[model samples]
Target: MSAPHGINPNIPHSARVYDYWLGGKDNFEADRRVAEQTMAAVPGIRESARNNRAFLGRAVRHLSRLGVRQFLDLGTGIPSQGNTHEVAQAEAPESRVVYVDNDPIVMAHARALLTSTPEGRTAYLEADVREPRTILEHPDTLATLDFTQPIALVMVAILMHISDADDPEGLVKAYAQALPAGSYLVLSHLTLDLIDKRTADDYVAATSSQAMHRTPRTGERISRYFDGFDLLEPGLVAVSKWRETPLFPDEPAWMYAGVGRKR
Candidate 1:
């Protein structure tokens, strides 16, 4: 009922750290420091972030073109160029979007800046992905979306922050179950599949202070999230290889991304 906690500049948040990595200036000193440390652990981290964001844009545009007009974007981080709604509405002006995030700073900024096309609607909810029901059943979401229709559930780069103990697969299922048949689940996750074990371990250790954990899953483990759905082409490939741009190669990025249609 009450508003969530406000931004604590003292603590480093994963979203703000990611914003800093993408060359955005919205991060605090703590966030920047941690981001730098993580980057040091994995040299390609900043480029990985940029590529992951580009993947998000491409996926949203593809889904929008497919007639998926409603989007539930979780872990909606600090607004940057080419966000979900921006890409979706660019293709279909009437696409409705519901951006959800636990971060109060993201909530504040989203409220002030994540605007939608006049024909469409956009709403922000201060909610956590772990609490999928709260987000799916929230009044704001109920008013903006029709669950009976095909909706796109986007969980990009955020699941890595969730530890295995949090049951990421279960959380994904919970949200996916709320959507109707023909809906899609779009995700891009961090994996150590490409890097050395020591480097991955160091990267995980660097994020420990912020309650962030990385699960470097194999392609098989990552595929579990789409258990009940039919995967799109090039199923469960590295983020860089998922319908990639001309610049991306067959080689894997540090992240894995895929989309599945609920059958």
Candidate 2:
């Protein structure tokens, strides 16, 4: 099959799989197969995905209420309801947001669908997170945000896909170093802590695409990734417990989330 927006329709993209998990139809059979296989291995995975999305909304709203008007959302999956701009602009009409993603499909859909309030602004940048310098140097990001002020760097349920060899920690530190003091790092990542090793390996194996490869980190490691920042209350907790009333009080999202102010 030919690719759309330069995206191979046959390859299972991580973002597409996530979209399917969140009950969106912007995925192909390849994505659905991997999502279902992972779901078969782990129950309530779809619900967990929803819970993660809810956490994103809560985090954005919470930060926006605190007067952080600029946002740089990396690895922003398929544009869905309650997106970062929608959540932030709702809190303040003048909020500015820049969504970045490596996936062409996401960029295509986002360019066509995501828009901001007339008083606010939203822009899309197609770039890899590994190149933090490129993102920080992008003209659109600089134009949309004022570096003198605080901005939120959002990485929801995305960093786990970065391989250890890629030096994920160092990459995060680069982004952190670029932001001014008072800027926040908002992140949610998958973990292997709750599930058994076999299940973790099986889940990783089941999703066989190199582009979709994931390395589930432990909670402690994920916490350490926020080294340059001071965590807020209930730091590095499950996504569902992050500053929001839990929709499903009992089920664990098996993901850790935190919002830390750069020191």
Candidate 3:
């Protein structure tokens, strides 16, 4: 069957808009329009996007330094600079990464752009985060990752798309259960704490065309995902606050990020 309209260039996609926010050129006019609208609603959106990406890098570096050699990055958007494997393998050439996403466009580019060092491996699975079992059971993932070993599960900027109806907490728990005790769960999600309720509601409504769901969650609610895990230092802070450096200080953003290790 032909790809759906949302996957077509004419339709706006959440991933493409996110890509645009990160200053990427893979998005279409439709994507840019919605992205701009979102920005107008949330002025710090671009900073949030950049900060979220930087958080991914920092978390990956920290995980690599801690000797985590495998990664399962779900909701893998269109291939952008400093992707999961790129950052992880840069720190440890022997790192193995499996990226998962439902978007066919992302899958296509991921196949072309997500290359790895000979000493390591990188594979992309065109699957939805809602189907965690299918992703974890995929043969490519099974071949590349040993479930018994520690793996970093990166869910950056993706959970916001999963509506409350989808049971985001349950999904996290399911994925966590599939990993070993030493595994890590790194995630960044959008919240409305910093913005007015009407503004947050408008932002969520603006992206309704793509069926996007944005939940303005509390720190406590976001922490529920890491229920069984031991949270790292500075637990569940805004994306900008998670290990902020002089280059990127803690600032008010609409997103929260954290990394936790399975006990």
lDDT string, candidate 2, 1-263, tens digits: 24585667787898999999888889998888888888887766777788889999999999998999999999999989899999999999999999999998899889999888999999999999999999999999888988988989998988888989999999899988878999999999988676666766666666554456877788989988899899987898888888858666525357788999998
The number of clashing residue pairs in each candidate reads 0, 0, 0
Please provide, for model 3 over 1-115, each residue's C-alpha lDDT reduced to its tens digit, 9 standing for 90 to 100. Answer: 2343556766677788889998888888878888888777666778778888889889999999999999999999988878999988899999999999888888888998899
Let me know the TM-score candidate 1 reaches against the reference structure.
Answer: 0.92
Better of 1 and 3 by lDDT: 3
Residue pair clashes in candidate 1:
none
Task: Give all TM-scores, in the order shown.
Answer: 0.92, 0.94, 0.92
Error of 3 at 40 (Å): 1.5
Q: Give the top-scoring candidate (TM-score).
A: 2
For candidate 1, write residues 1-263 as lDDT tens digits.
12246656777788888999888888888888888887876767788888888889988998888899999999999999998999998998899999999888888889999999998999999888899889989999999999989999999988877878999999999998899999999998888787777777776776666544556667777889898999998888777777857234423368888999999
RMSD of each: 3.2, 2.0, 2.7
**Alpha carbon deviation, residue 102, candidate 2 (Å):** 1.0
Q: lDDT: which candidate is best?
A: 2
**What value does the lDDT take at residue 183 in candidate 1?**
97
